[model samples]
Target chain A: MTPYDIILTVLTTLLALYLISFALYIVRVLKGPTIPDRVLALDSLGYDLAAFMLILSIYLNSPMMAVCALSLALWIYALDIYVAKYLEAKEVGG
Target chain B: MSEMLPVIMAFVAALISIVATWLAVQERDMLIATLFSALQSTCYALIYYLLMAPDIVLVYLPVSVGILPLITIILIKKTERYEE
Candidate 1:
């Protein structure tokens, strides 16, 4: 009825959707037929998690937590780059 | 409902992380196992956030998800991909 209640409902629904996507990502990671499949799924999972954390921070009234979300977003690409380098170079280090 | 949402979210994230840990341990492919471990760490970060610990989440995200996985991938490349 109230505006706060509307916001709560929307956030809860979004969180549920996020959880569902997380489940799907895990399934892909677990049963993926190829290395790239798993890597792609993990990448998506990390991006989704970053968004989820941002929303969660808002819901929890802790703006500081957004920094974690930003850091997570930036760091996830390192995994992608590392995997790509390993797949290509056949040697991982610089 | 408002008061209990955090608890429920934390519980669900914990469950997901547990499953991820099991999958990681059971996986024979080192690369995939490392990815699973990263997923597990992601869930742990969520749980930490839900518990009102942003500080822990900040520390945990880089170490467990970023550095740990990078190190494991390097090790995998140094050795082999499959466990057998």
Candidate 2:
């Protein structure tokens, strides 16, 4: 097989790995005893998903999808900040 | 076999999204439910990406994951944390 096929195989394997971890993250989100725990799990989940998307874009030969991955990472970080503010001050500033 | 990888990945993402939606709907804590909903949206975005719809993914990502959760969280803060 060519290098392209090898890269495709690796990317596919990584996608599966990410999905399995996503299942674990969802479990943590659903079953965690405290709100912070769920938020942390969600944060990691989003970050890892962004990485997965980047790899997917490379595999698919679509550079535009990389932009989505960047936006996803930023939005997930914003989510963390929002949760932290709400948890600390009991308010999310308008 | 390799050509169908995207289809398989999309199916798995869709299944995960279903689980997330159910969890979000049934959870007692509004905040946790919102997080689950965000997870659901993330999965949907992945599904769109796998299906080669970059435009839909772009619009869906901001609206569902960012704005919708922010709105729901604000409502949760205004009203209550627990469902009851």
Candidate 3:
């Protein structure tokens, strides 16, 4: 097979790997005893998903789709910050 | 294999979303349920990317993952943590 096919295979494998982590994150979100644990799991899952989107953009040959990934990462980080502060009682409705 | 990559990703995203939606509904804690809803939205964004809908992804991520959860959490803090 060509290098392109090989790259596709690699990307597909990476997608599967990220999805596995996604599944584990779901489980953690379900079984987590504390509020923070669930939030942390959601944090990692969002970041992993952004990485997956980046890889997918490359595989699909759409450089514009990476814009979605970038925005997702940024917004999720903002959510994390808001949640963290909310947890700390620093902000009430952030 | 290359041609089928998008199709495969779409299928997987669908499956994950189904499970995520169910998990969100079943969760007892409002926080965990909100997190699962975020996960469900993330899966939908991936589906949009797979389906070549960049505009939707741009809007969906910030609205669902960012704003929605923050609003929900604030509501939760004012109310109760555990669902009853």
Best by DockQ: 1
DockQ of candidate 3, scored on C-alphas against the true complex (2 decimals): 0.68
User: What overall lDDT, based on C-alpha atoms, would model 3 receive against the true structure?
Assistant: 0.81
- Candidate 2 vs candidate 3: which has greater DockQ? 3
Indicate the DockQ of the complex predicted as candidate 1.
Answer: 0.76
- Which candidate has the top score in lDDT? 1
Compose the digit string of candidate 1's lDDT tens values, residues A1-94.
9998899889988887878878888789878999899889988988988888889888877788788888888888888998898888765445
Off by over 4 Å in 2: A91-94
RMSD of 2: 2.4
Docking class of 1: medium
Which regions of candidate 1 are displaced past 4 Å?
A: A91-94
Q: Provide the lowest-lDDT 10-residue window in model 1 chain A.
A: A85-94
Models ranked on DockQ:
1, 3, 2
Chain A TM per prediction:
0.90, 0.87, 0.84
lDDT of 2 by residue, A1-94 (tens): 9998888888778777877888898789778888899889989988988898898888788887788888888888878887887887655453
Error of 1 at B27 (Å): 1.7
Q: Is candidate 1 or candidate 3 better by lDDT?
A: 1
